[model samples]
Target chain A: MMKSKHIPEEQLVDYLLGNIGEWDAKQIKAHLYHCKKCQYLLSDWQFLLSQDHKKFQPSQSMKDRIQHSINQMEGKSFKRRTVIGKPGLLFATIACVFLIFYSVHSYYQDINTRNYEIAENDEIPPETIQSAPHTQQIKVTPVSEFNQINGYVWVNRNRNEMLLEVDGLEELINQDYQLWIIYMDNSIDHEILPTQNGMTRMLFRDIDVDEFKKLKASVEPRGGSIEQTGPDTFIVEFQ
Target chain B: MSNDQENIQLLKDIAAGSRQAFDIFYEKYISFVYQIAFSIVHNHAEAEDICHDVFLEVYQKARQYSEEKGSIKAWLAVKTKSRSLDRLRKNKPLLIHRLENLSGSKKMEPGADLQFLHSLEKHLIVEALKAIPIEQREAIIRSYYNGETHNEIAMTMKKPLGSVKSLIRYGLNNLRKQKALMQWVGIDRGEKK
Candidate 1:
């Protein structure tokens, strides 16, 4: 199964609402950097959300204070531009450099703090479908009559994350269930499905689902196989 | 000139250190900035302080504004919202976390819960929000206003993560459809006239 190439509407909404995790936010930002369609959608959401608030007027004193600050800034900048010679210019340049460095440092610090907060307070459940519109849900059906194992794969291509859940997968003697992710370019990545009570639930991060073409499960040697050298119990192909 | 064009011109003038332009621009958008801050902080004095800080930043950073990025109103909204959230975070470190308790188990249909509804304005955006279910609206507002994440929202709403995501997704989709319908109706009315 393949999803729409565009970033899903729900994802744009998530990004706009700032509900997205750091990794997913980074992925969406990277995509929006090159994608004009998504940029427009994001802008639309921004406009709509911006207007959702009711109007409240500030006191005249607050307005006066802001105006006073603005006037002082304008005066200082004008004086600096007009009166600055070589020494003043050099000093101004140094101040500018320091400001830029401090801004950059503060930005990194903010990001780190936010990441820490998210990690500490917000923990996503493994079964949750992140960005459902971008997720490709594949039903891994039994390939043969003897295979009673049931499995499903959820690949969120945008976030490069996947969730693989299997049920009714009875244990095999002297064998392990190996999961294979077949790539679009004919490359393959395999992982041993560690099961607990006839159920396997695995969440993989940083695995690009766009590269995935097929998912297959096979019974392999006790340690798992280097390749797909076992009988295919379940298989799913992406188009 | 169009409102956006006029605002852009004022921004350009403010960037060039024109106090008159700055005043005009401030007069035009102060209510919007103040309102957004007030909504977030729910305290008039703090919101006023946030507004003062935001306008000062706008004055200093006007040169950095670009119409190619977005409209001036949207840019100011972003500035106001960012500053207001910063104020909220600074004043009460646990206020956002405490907001989770406010998300009660209220099962109300669209238009049934007017508690979250602000003063009804003429904007279709507000109307569109009014048309959405209460839970979804709360999720979106908490996420957007209170800066709560999906997981936080799920916990706050006493729902699963998937359900919270669905609520936001469906809520946004419904708003988008309502906006599109409003635009279509506006065009039809224009043609009729």
Candidate 2:
């Protein structure tokens, strides 16, 4: 009976480097396939080469910098903001946006309750969009376990028109998703109510994307509230 | 906490929302990853950013990793390479840190593994490596520190695979004898090796 050949160390290196002849490499491969010891040793060798000796850590400042970067990247999808700086613009804009939002929301509610009919004797007045229509696409991700609300947002600049597709959000019976837009400079924010059913097809011409650094959705009671927070809050930043 | 799987386990924990796991995993590999990034980008700040971006991708896209398909090193190496090449062009830098909140996780939560591994008798480990012969030291450093595979180490060292393996095995054995490391990392450190 022929003895199985053990692979030579030089041959193994040669094989790894593609320096061995074809026949020799094939023979080495055949032997290695049958050799469990070689495989284990090889894996250890692989481990050693790839191990971090804790040799050179990026400075602590570097770690903080990197961690901060991770935090920021993570920050984009879901973060809560306090009314930090000047409050005048933030409050005024939210009020105005919500006012328009209520009008549109009430208009839709009345239309639905009236069963989609515009009777000849109906007392409702015709509505007009005061601004030109503009649109921007926005996407969101889950902030935390509770704030898993995520979806698409659309803003029409100048037209004050906005639409939200609350893709992953599950509707709560008494809850609503309030949309908020915050400027990058922390100068102001605009808040509005989005149509439920994933904010689908509702045209809001008031909210502008470029005016905000981030878009937020906070779950609140029906009819909404001044506070932009609740059991769930979601955020996404403009790239 | 064993060979090969420790890193995979760390990543799995990160996916499972273990902030401590993420901390240790980065602690374990940041230097190695940074080395790869620096080697390519040749700029400290850029390399740091590249390293930051790579881990950020790993954490954010953890679900994308199929344990059945790939290893973390390969995933990170690829990400680092890709992100580094991206530096050749223009890309928005990601800022994850709150410059205001620079306090690190120096104070570990009780039962946090990072409590041990964070500092982990760092001086002893460095000293242990220094105690070994330069040949074994270089082999171990490349294999363990730089994360070179056996073949890569051999290519770099101009040595045979068997010799590279022997050098590392011996270096690791000598490193394990450091009582300070034994006390600090505990026995699992050697066992993992």
Candidate 3:
């Protein structure tokens, strides 16, 4: 159980250097939001960097080359604008608008459906998925017994996909849980969404599973699969 | 003109794809960018090339600039440093020689005054960083200069997620303390009053 209170020294360097990934960055961010000491420390480092900024000085030739490059790019852009023409531009604009509208509408609908499914799930909100306990196998229990949870399974209306994330999962290994988007009509096969490394939640969209009432997590071999040879590790049913 | 106001105007012109404004920006910050690059790369020619490439990237990606996220200076500094580091990593043999030369110089006396004010500033920063642990210094440098995210730092450093967070927290805390101390003992004589 790595308590959030103490961040390793190495990681602090990585975080300040912007070398950490999004998940870790988010975790650090959450920690920073709560930890004033860390926030002040970060601000101080930023100030140091700001002060260091004064030492930088470029040569005159470099300036000339950059100006030359910018000039060339501008010329190309001007040529492109002329080539595009009013009618061509108008058609392109219309096409872009139509595509954007279609994408947004479909995306919105998809998210709405995914959210509805997640909400109907009697299981805990996906956000509440904590860092799993470190073990060979993760026991997916209902949220009722765990500490406070913060998770979300909403659709990204723009992307037309359901984005699900369960933070605070106890770290576990060997046995990984696989997410299955069970569809209605029995015509569409169950879709297995990919899980991010060390992520406890799953998100999928563009799934027309309005009639599907359940989302299941099955224990699979390390790198999860479409096949569900293993038993259901966790089950969340839509109301 | 105030740096911030000039930056805002430059960014606006950049967003509009004005090459002249970009040239102005290049002129203004090229030296600063070069010095940082040279410090990391430790070579004049390569540093110049890196600076050129960084500015070119800025030109190409200017439209993507948004004031809400960060300032142009910060963005340029980050970009230049990352590119220089990447070059440094790729040319490890060269870096080894440079590092050897740097450590061998032994020109820096502990309490000696640096020639340029900028050198003094660098000395102070590096000294402050030294007061903290290496890991913290590494984290600060990577995050600030390399423009990497927290997870990337963890992966690169091969440390657990939690420890990385703490290192950054503690590192920053120590830095703040040093900064406060420095402010308290201002180099200026008037501060004695």
RMSDs, each prediction?
23.0, 24.4, 19.4
Stretches of candidate 2 above 4 Å error?
A1-57, A73-78, A81-239, B91-193
Q: Give the number of the best model, judged by TM-score.
A: 3
Considering only N, C-alpha and C atoms within 3 Å, which residue pairs clash in candidate 1?
none
Reference contacts preserved by each model: 0.27, 0.14, 0.21
lDDT of 1 by residue, A1-239 (tens): 01225565545655776656798778888888887766765764554455444545677798788866666543532333233457658878778768777865554343212100000001124235544678878887887753667778787777767777777777676577887777676656665665544667777666656766778888876445545568887887877
Candidate 3 or 1, higher TM-score: 3
DockQ of 1: 0.12
Worst 10-residue lDDT window, candidate 3 chain A: A115-124
Best-first order by lDDT: 1, 3, 2
**lDDT tens digits, residues A112-224, model 2?**
12111110101111232222245556676667764555566656666545554555556555455665555555443323333322332233333444555666667765434
**What lDDT tens digits, residue by residue, belong to model 3 across residues B21-108?**
8778877877767766765666778888788777766664454454533455655665565566545544534444444444444363
TM-score of each: 0.34, 0.31, 0.36
Residue B53 CA error for candidate 3 (Å)? 1.3
- Which of candidates 1 and 2 reaches a greater lDDT? 1
DockQ of each: 0.12, 0.07, 0.10
By DockQ, the candidates rank as: 1, 3, 2
